[model samples]
Target: MIFIPLWQRLLVALATVAAILLALPNMFYGRVEVANDARASIAQGLTSPELEADAGLWPSWLPSGLINLGLDLRGGAHLLAEVQVSDVYASRMDSLWPVIRDALAADRDTVGFVTREDGPPSELHVRISKPEGAARALEIVRGLARPVASLSGGGSSDIEVRAQNDLLIVNLSEAERAATDDRTVQQALEIVRRRIDEVGTREPTILRQGADRILVQVPGVGSAQEVKDIIGTTAQLTFQPVVQRTSNKDADPGAGNILVPSVDEPGVYYILDRAAVVTGEDLTDAQPTFDQNGRPAVSFRFDPQGARAFGEYTGAHIGEPFAIVLDNEVISAPVIQSAIPGGSGIITGQFTPEESTDLAVLLRAGALPAELTFLEERTIGPELGADSIQAGKNAAYAAAVMVVLFMIASYGVFGAIACVALAINIVMIFASLSLLGATLTLPGIAGIVLTMGQAVDANVLIYERMREELRRGASPVKAVQEGFDKAFSAILDANVTTFIIAAIMFFVGTGTVRGFAVTLAMGVVTTMITGVYVSRVLIALWFARTRPKTIVV
Candidate 1:
């Protein structure tokens, strides 16, 4: 008589039950999603009556994970941005000025008075009073160069120093520039990812497309402009000593000073020191809060180094005014009444509560290394996603119905068993997706439809084998045993080859192609379990209940 081991049968039953449980949440997707969001909010210390009610929609004991929908199946914003990597070169040169000045100052008798001359942003030109000291100036400047900090920039220094006439010219080395460009792009990618994650958007596809481009797809955002608003602001916060406040927009602020317009005052400007006492990079934490006058503001704390620098600057300039500048505009210029320690401060501005919250998020995410210029942007509508989802459902349903009918008509009892296995295979596929938190796209749906047809191939092979055995006058029990035993090898081989192809696609493809590969790969695993093992167990149980002398293959 055909039989299956007790332990094997129990294992299959347990897996089936577990898969069904895992997949149950998807059937109530809307309710489960609301419960998930509410739970997240509650965990973050936010609570209200509506939140409590929503959180109660799903029991805490049940699995809450769901397959995330990809951008093609969920409305969102798409942006293709190119990072201005050259901007960092200018910044690097600007920051190097003080070091170059101080280094050359030690030998002032030879180099004479050093003054910076206007030139390209990427190059720093320092003019000395004595043209004969050019070689000495170049030596001092080159001494400040450090080895490039990248593998590809092996023995190259970060800066190239050379003298032309009475001036010492400094520029970033080519290798160093290449490394900086890569680092700038990578930093921009991570900052964008963190900002999106802070806002709790789900499964955003933020990827570096090329050398200096980033591709961002955010599901559930209203528009591309909204995304740009969140990420495009440089958020370059700086604290600089104010030279003088003036009403003229075009006033020249002399050497080593910049004229910045006030954010809140019309046509008013503040001439501030070029070098900042501290910048946003030193910030360790930031949060949204109200000012003493109950206006929305952001509070920030700094790291140890930043704290020391800030404390020293404030202590030395107790009676001086310092401007809190953000993105090249002065947000406020308050006079220092006393020395402030601890490196903690509040940024007061004309901000609403939402604006303050967004600012806090940006500060906490850290500033982008380079500015981004958006080259292309598009917003997908929810109605389009809804229609695509419906179309996918219709296609899946049609595929399932046709597969079910064909299997039943072909093998009769065996075909019915195959149909049951096919249903279980689908549930297991979805369970795997939910557990792995994979994103499902429109192409992913097509993968599932394709899997339904392939799932029954194992059943067909076994039934045909049984027919061959029966024609040779084999006993009914002998035929059933030999059918499963002989057909497993072919089943394994077919699924294994398909699995290899899926793996290749997953690794080599991008975006929606990977989505298709994910579903197809998951289907291969489920097909082996449900189609081969489960079908055999069901057949064994069927034979045990009613042992027939003769069987129709």
Candidate 2:
């Protein structure tokens, strides 16, 4: 007979009981999900009588986690968006002008007066007031270049400045462009994640695709357009010094200033200073609140550095109008009422409460580095997901009944022990998934059915070995012991090989393939424990109590 130690038997029993308890919450998945959501809402300070009562449904001491249903199961929206990375190049060149101007001005003796010339959006052209000074001007601009900040990019400046005739041509270097592209994609991904998280949507998938695209999926969201509306706005908030306000559309504001049309008033344009006093990056917090006049407004607080800068600027520029620009348009140009030292201020834009709230959320989430163009959008409905779940359930039930009946008919009493172990294996698989917060897809259900067959295969090998030993006239005890000892190697080898395959699929595949691999890999582990160890223990216990001289196969 197999000499199973007392500790091993106790350990198996303990694990089995723990798994069943942990998996019990999944039976009440809807209630647990509601409780979790209500708890999250309470933590966010949004409390209601209904929410509190719902939260009370699941006790705090109990494990309330449920297996997260993926998009195919719960139904939601999917969107693919490509980031306009080239847009950053223009802005980069525009910002480089001041640095170039200051650099060239330092060598006034060698380089004469410099002026920016209109050129292609990708290139910055600087005109040397004196044609002969182009070489010196180019030298000075190139000297300003620093090493690119990237692991793969060696020592190379961000931009390459070369002299072309009387103009200095400047464009982003190859290494610098790669670095900027990576930074832009990462920034866009984070911004999208934050925006989705603010809405309290559960398990939104935001990942970078290729060189310049992002894939976003939000489960339980109604439509793709709704997600777009939330994250589409650039929300490029900037505060600029107002140069002049003009009603004439044809007025020339000259260099170093931009003409932006007013957002609140029609046919009015404001010439604002190109350099911003402060941008949205300086904002620490923002919320939708009522202004002094009880109108919907956005209240914002600035970081420490921003507070000091704003205080100094407002103290010196009292009575001057400051233009608040959003997405390159002047929203309002309010005159400085007084020397306001505090960093907190309210913005009134004649907005509805919904608009105000949305603006505040955008501000808090930060701005996207580049604009995203929607390439594809799709919405999956709950009805389809429900149908899928029903089909999967039927298939699982059919598979389970077949496996159970086959095991009972083939090995009789020993087959019944294997059936008990198979049930525990299923429970353990779900418990492990719940503990790990793994998502379940239709393919994952298929993995479970596949595990059922593999689970019984180990039992078949053991029973066949015992029958062979009995045919050789070996005693019952020796037959059982030899059966388990011989079958152990095959069981271990088969499960190990299956585990390796599942691991490879998980790492190499995406989406549904990964879901399948997760369940399949987990099933292998649970089967090894319940199938080999638990089955052996059951047989050993039966033999200890009933030592039959001849066993019925």
Candidate 3:
């Protein structure tokens, strides 16, 4: 007689129950989501009557993990942004000015008097007093060139220096530019991801596209504009010594100075030094706080090097006005009253509470390396997502109903048993998705429906084998054992091949394809557990109770 051990039956029963419990949260998705958000807020030291009520909606002891819905399923904003990589070239040239100036100054006898000459933003031009000293200036600049910090740029220098008559022209090398482009895109991707995560959105898709573009998909956000507003801020903060205040937007601040408009004051501008005393890159921490007058502001602390430099600069230039610039606009120009040795300072402006909070978030997330120009943007509405969900449910229900009827009509009792295993298989798939925190897209639903149909294949193989065994004059007990044993190899082979393809699809593909692959791969595993083992346990229990001598084929 066929026998499934008591331990095996109990294990299957326990696992099936556990899967059902884990997938239970999805049934009340909205309530559970609210409860989760409330719990998260409470954990962060927040309290409110409404939050407390929401937190009590779900029991803490039960599993609260739910499958994350993908952007296509939940509705969200999608953006394709192209990084302005050329902007970095200008910044690089600007930074190189001080280094080149200092280097040429060290050899004043040979290089003579050096003065920065205005030219293109992407190139630095320094005219020397002595025309014959061009060769020496180029030599000094070339000596300062460092090796590119990338494997592909081995033995290549970061800067290419050449002498154009009396002027020393400097530009970034091609290899260095390529490496910088890659790093800029990667840094932008990470900063964008951090900004989105700060808003507590789930399963956002942030990925690099091509050479200089990024694709961002944030699910459950209000609109594309909202998503853009969150990540679009450059947050380029700098503190520069103020040259003077002016009202003329067309006023040239002469060499080594820039004109920036005021953030709070209309028509007013400040001519500030081109070189900054400290930048946002030196900030270690930032948070929303209030100024001395109880006005909304952002407080920031700097790193050790920045702290030392700021303290020395403030001590040397007491009572002098310094412009706090952000994204080419002056936020405020405050005079230094005392040396700020503590490395902490407040940024005051005509800011609302929400604006202060958002500025804090942006400062904490760090500045984007370069600007992002939105090439494409799309916003999906919740109503559309609801319709998609309903359609997907209808498709799944239809597939399940058709499969159930066909299985019941085909092999009588055995087919009915297979339908039960199929039900368990579906539960296991959802449970796996929940546990993995995977996003389920519309394609994922198609995968589940496909799994339901394929789930009965193993049962069909075993039942057909049993029919052959019965026709060969074997008793029901022997036929049952042989049927399972003979069908195991074929089932294993089929699932193994399908699993390989699914793995390939998962690793190589992105977005929707990956969602489909995840469900398909999970189905393969659950099918094996239910179709072969669970069916055997149920059949064995029936045999032990009924003790049938013969069975219909």
Clashing pairs in 1: none
Q: Residue-wise lDDT of candidate 2 within 1-553, one digit each (tens)?
A: 5589999999999999989878888899888888998998899899999999999998888877688777888888899999998888887887788889889988887778887877777788888777788888877888888899998788888999888788898999999999999999999999999999998887777878789999898888888888998889899888889999899888886665688999889999999877677788889999999988888999999899888778888889999999988888887789997876798887888789999999999999998888999999999998888888888889989999998899899988899999999999999999998899888888998999899999999989989999999999998888888898899899999999999999999988877888899999999999899878999899989988887878866
lDDT of 3 by residue, 282-374 (tens): 899999999999999999999999999899999999999988998899999999999889888999999999999999999999999899999
Rank by lDDT, descending? 3, 1, 2
Worst 10 residues of 2 by lDDT: 249-258
Give the alpha-carbon lDDT of every model. 0.91, 0.88, 0.91
RMSD of each: 1.8, 2.6, 1.5
Error of 1 at 215 (Å): 1.1
Candidates 1 and 3 compared: the better one by TM-score is 3
All candidates: TM-score: 0.96, 0.91, 0.97
TM-score for candidate 3, please give it: 0.97
Model 2 misplaced regions, further than 4 Å: 1-3, 59-61, 249-256, 301-316, 337-346, 544-547
**What pairs collide in candidate 3?**
none
* TM-score-sorted candidate list, best first: 3, 1, 2
